[model samples]
Target: MNAVKIIAASPQEALEQVQAQVGPDAVILNVRKLPIDGMKKLWAKPQVEVLAAAPEQEPGEQESLRQLAVKVQQLEGELHARGVVPTETVPSPDAKLPPKVMQMIRAAQGDKLEEALLPAVQVLEQIGLLPSHARWLSAQSRNFLGATKPRNLPEEMELLREVLSEYWHQLARRLEKPGNPVRVLVGTPGSGKTTVLAKWATQETFLRQRPSRIWRLDADRPNTAEFLSLHGELLQVPVERVWDPDEQPPEDTLRLVDFPGVPADQP
Candidate 1:
């Protein structure tokens, strides 16, 4: 329920700032025309701006709006002094979790496992499972089987290991035949392309019998370069840099190219 103060030449300009920062749906809570001398001694005429609150009107929108509000509040004073306002929200801690998990956390229900949902989604997503599948996996993890006596530790560990092994084997089988690896693979932010690349490289190293060589065509980011470089060093694999596409790979070497998965804007 915080309010932001902004000074603009006109209400329209103030509304633009609100829309650009908080968006178009912001409710104009209050607006006032004020003398410039109140804060600054620079202008002869008065300035005006509309103050607005654009609370998220729907259950699904609350988290994002709350996050935006917090960020706007943090920068409000600085923005006022500098004559600018934030146009986007700071990233939220729960941003990577699925929307359903966010919704459940907002609900704050006794029956919901909101605390567990973030980690649950992360683990399942890392294991190459989709949201629908992960939802089922979370439910499975909650099984107590009526009243549970102290189970034999050894038997329980064995059962858990077997389940994990089968789960991964099924995941691995989903991959397209370890064919000639792609020239370049791209994915959006948070997509596990880099990890998948390392996993693929390690599999290739073991399967090829001969030492595997990695050639980096281009890294989408510094982090990607760091991960690949570290993995290559650990595996003692030779890595080459190819800045140009026309540059040829080493003779009889496996080449892996990583590209930034930039999504195309829709028309």
Candidate 2:
């Protein structure tokens, strides 16, 4: 699958360009208003940018396309670093990969890398990484080992920890800061939406010393309302069941709305 960004005078024009260039199977990823340029800001209207991605291809072709896309991205980065414009068209997915990239792909597919990294993979798996996540971590560990050899098991484990720590730090940094005055949690049944909301409320009230109000819109779940109320009482915060859609929370307080869990199939 391919992705591209297009800018036009309006959203409709941008979408028309996407459909023309990316084909009818392309899906719109995002649309945003682009900033008006210097002189254009005085008289011209702002442009709109649309990001779109092509539909998935067949399974056998999909893997090849993914690898090609990654190589293309790497090539683009190299070109950008050297202040050179990257070529417009990348090699087709069916085209043969370069020797070095082919070797890397082969090594990733082979059992030798997996065997060498099994201990680290096991360690990560034991620490709550899902099977897929463990495999991904193992692959990254293997790549790291290829570039720099570790002398012992302890060193290998340290490298694994470093990789995990870097990823954890990145994930934490990417988490949205609590900027919204009114936050809502909505998810499917048994999705732990209530638990997450309660935890956020706890952090706001006790950790940040900020007053918070909890509203339960899930009247169907009386038990959840009671659970939130119990915690509210302990936190000395007001918990209300939102019977009316237009009901507003108290002023100068962080408001958290707990929504009813909808069925996945329904939505």
Candidate 3:
């Protein structure tokens, strides 16, 4: 099931709206008052921000979701072990998916599809997507699943898988095209910064068919990961090591850098 964010004048109103749109099976995760800023705070009625999700339909999905939950817990433990707390994850400016992806986004923003988009949105949030990204993905998925409707739970799950595959393809095509010439990955320990850099670098050199270079540099502390260099050798891409503050990426060549194990407070 997907998660959705609902805003209303009161908690009761917000809960009622979530139940109405997402059905009574909706599970409320968080509810907080939204503060208005400046002079508007004086006149505005307090708004409630409620994060809720719909119940899953199938036993198989329940198991899969349980596995995902376990993994999330593991990652949380890892984060705490490193003294880091990440509040938000922002997507890249060119993060949009293609193959008619923008059209679906337009449809989702309309008030008419609000109800239809809630289920996808709710499920996405429960799985860790920010509400905005969840809404966008749900909107795209809703439009992607149009015309031919799913007849049953199994059919609906199958459609979801198909939609996911199509989105991945669009993402690969996005990487294959000439855009975002420089890519940088940053995060605390065990946050997949290195893994993310590897995937994107792979996409650039192999999938996108472009020349690329990997830079391993230290920011505040000494960088100590050999993963990128080994992977670069395997991928037949040039790998540069050591801390270089005055350096610039080679003219017109894609640059992938992995700066891991650095504390968030540092540069």
Candidate 4:
């Protein structure tokens, strides 16, 4: 494989350049927004950098590309060590993060965390927590750091995890149980609301031996009623299509209501 980096005014432009140079079969490895420098920061738009690899070539070419990649990595490391490149590329988190989460952060924020809070943020990322959740936990950890004596990275991580787990446990206990007998599933089109309803109905009818019925709201979309009817057959329950608000099922049975999905632009 032959890999090359392309920088352009926008991601779309960069993609065009890659397609033109390496053809459609090229694999995109990474995309990042580059930082602007000096006077260019004032008026020039930030550029997007795309790293792409051509499909497998000859054996000699593959070996050459591998060597080139290693050399490039070494050069980048040297630049970072010499302070020629910005520190944003280097995440100073003491712990390693999961590859998936690391990729997500890199794509979203260029793998950058505030330097002072890198350790805490890294611990959160390692546990596969969302960025918002990590930020909140990081803030609480910072408070603890200030109130107590300094600790090692591992100790700090353990303390923060304990604190966060306690908070979630307390939250789960405080949440009120659902009082309403009727349950409704809602989401955008093809969001798996119907499938979820089917699974729930199956659990009730087969596992718990509780009687359940499905009520689907009629809308512009097609095949919803048919789909629910199929699930109804499997569950040995009746599936009803309701257009009017006043339509009701038997009072004794568990009812699963399926509301039509609305587009974001619709009123």
lDDT of 2 by residue, 148-176 (tens): 66664445556676677777888978875
As a TM-score, model 4 comes out at 0.39
Q: Between the candidate structures 1 and 4, which one is better when assessed by TM-score? A: 4
Candidate 1 TM-score, true structure as reference? 0.29
Q: TM-score: which is higher, 3 or 4? A: 4
- Best-first order by TM-score: 4, 2, 3, 1
lDDT of 4 by residue, 36-69 (tens): 8899888999887777777565569557556655
Per-residue lDDT of 74-111 in model 3, one digit per residue for the tens? 65565557675323233333555673675666566654
Any idea what lDDT model 2 has? 0.64
Cα lDDT of all candidates, in order?
A: 0.53, 0.64, 0.64, 0.64
TM-score against native, each model: 0.29, 0.38, 0.37, 0.39
Better of 1 and 3 by TM-score: 3
TM-score of 3: 0.37
What would the per-residue lDDT of candidate 1 be over residues 111-180, giving only the tens digit for each residue?
A: 5333242232333344476655555454444452432332433333233334566668889789756545
- Residue 28 C-alpha lDDT in model 1: 47
* Candidate 1 lDDT score at position 263: 51
After superposition, which runs of candidate 2 have C-alpha atoms over 4 Å from their true positions? 1-118, 123-131, 143-150, 181-203, 206-209, 217-222, 225-227, 234-236, 243-252, 257-267
